[model samples]
Target: MISNEMAQRINTQINREMYSAYFYLGLSAQAETMNLKGVAAWFLAKHGEELAHALKMYRYLIDQDARVQLSEVAAPASVDGGVLPMFERTLEHERGVTATINEMVDFALSAKDHATNIFLQWFVTEQIEEEATVKDIIGRVRLFGDQGQSLLMIDNELAALAKQIGQGAATAA
Candidate 1:
């Protein structure tokens, strides 16, 4: 059985994941407004991924017989600059999530909640992948530039990535 404190922490994480979904959805809409269809598609895929993440945690809580508390998600911050700035924001958000997961892992370990610790290992791995992916995107944007033909090339690449992620989500489902 999961402890109340741990369950509460997981519930908070679920809320964060929901916020992440909302954040990505907002980014998708912003990309659409900028006419970056591929970027929009990518963010839309990310939104789906975030929702899946939240649901995964939600199910875990239910399986543990813990109460699930849903909370309101805050709106995503506005991005004033362009594509690079948007990606930078993504990286920043991901790093914050990593920190939260790390804290939870530490809490689980300290509390002798081995099962919860084990459960969180999946999230720890996921955070690593998420940060690395965003870093790679940032590097690519910097290397190729974020405008003209370069931007178009990046968009195509992102469209392919979106499709790949969408397929992975479907497979996981």
Candidate 2:
């Protein structure tokens, strides 16, 4: 069985994952309001991914014979500054998550919880990909600088990405 302290830490991370979903959902809403359908679709995919992350942790805790104590999630921040700012904020948020996960890995290693450490390696790799993806989007958005046709092109690309993500989930199901 996992120690109570470790379990509590994981539960806290789960709450953070929920907050991520909430934040991304707010981003999606803003994208939709701006008529950036593709951006909205992308954030919707992100929101789903965040929820899945939380559920993955939830299952892991249950398998470890730990009670899953959920904390309340805070409200999402406003995303009123348009796409670039939204993505910049997302990249910043992801960096924070990466740091937290690293701490968890360190704690697991010190506590000799090899199972948890091994499991968290997946998240470590995941964080790398997450940061890279967000950074790439930020770069692309900055290049466009709210230009009409260029921004539309990026939106189209994101729409395709959203579609691909949808199809992948459908196939997995």
Candidate 3:
């Protein structure tokens, strides 16, 4: 059985994951408003991933005989300017999540919770990939600044990535 403190911590992490989904959903709405269909699709895929992350934690908590108390998720801030700012925010958010995960890992280590630590290992690696992916998108968006053709190319690439991720998730499910 997980300790109350650990269970609470995991619950907070699950809420954060839900907030991430909300944030991505907001981004998707903004992208759709801007008529960037591919970008919107990418954000939608990310939103789904975030929801899955939350559910994974929720299920784990239930399996550990811990209460899964979900809190209300706040609305995400809409991006009004452009893609650069959005991607920059995405990178920043991922960095924040990495820090949270690292803190949890540290807590697990100090408490000698080997199982939690092992479970979090996947998240640590996943965060690295998440940060890299956001950074890459930021770079691409910056490079294509105000260039329609380049923007479309980047959008197509993102669309392909979204499709691949969706397919992988479906297969995993």
Instruction: Show how many residue pairs clash in every candidate, following the order shown.
Output: 0, 0, 0
True-structure lDDT of candidate 3: 0.88
Clashing pairs in 3: none
On residues 18-134, what C-alpha lDDT tens digit does candidate 2 reach at each position?
999999899999999999999999999888888888998999999999999998999997866788889899999999999999999999999998999988898899899889988
Per-model TM-score on C-alpha atoms: 0.99, 0.95, 0.96
Candidates' C-alpha lDDT: 0.95, 0.90, 0.88
Cα lDDT of model 1 by residue, 1-173, tens digit: 89999999999999999999999999999999999999999999999999999999999999999999998888888787999999999999999999999999999999999989999999999999999999999999999999999999999999999999999999999
Local error of candidate 2 at 100, Å? 0.7
Q: Give the TM-score of candidate 1.
A: 0.99
- Where is model 2 more than 4 Å wrong at Cα? 168-173
Query: Once superposed on the true structure, which residue ranges of model 1 sit more than 4 Å away at CA?
Result: none
TM-score of 2: 0.95
User: Ranking by lDDT, best first?
Assistant: 1, 2, 3
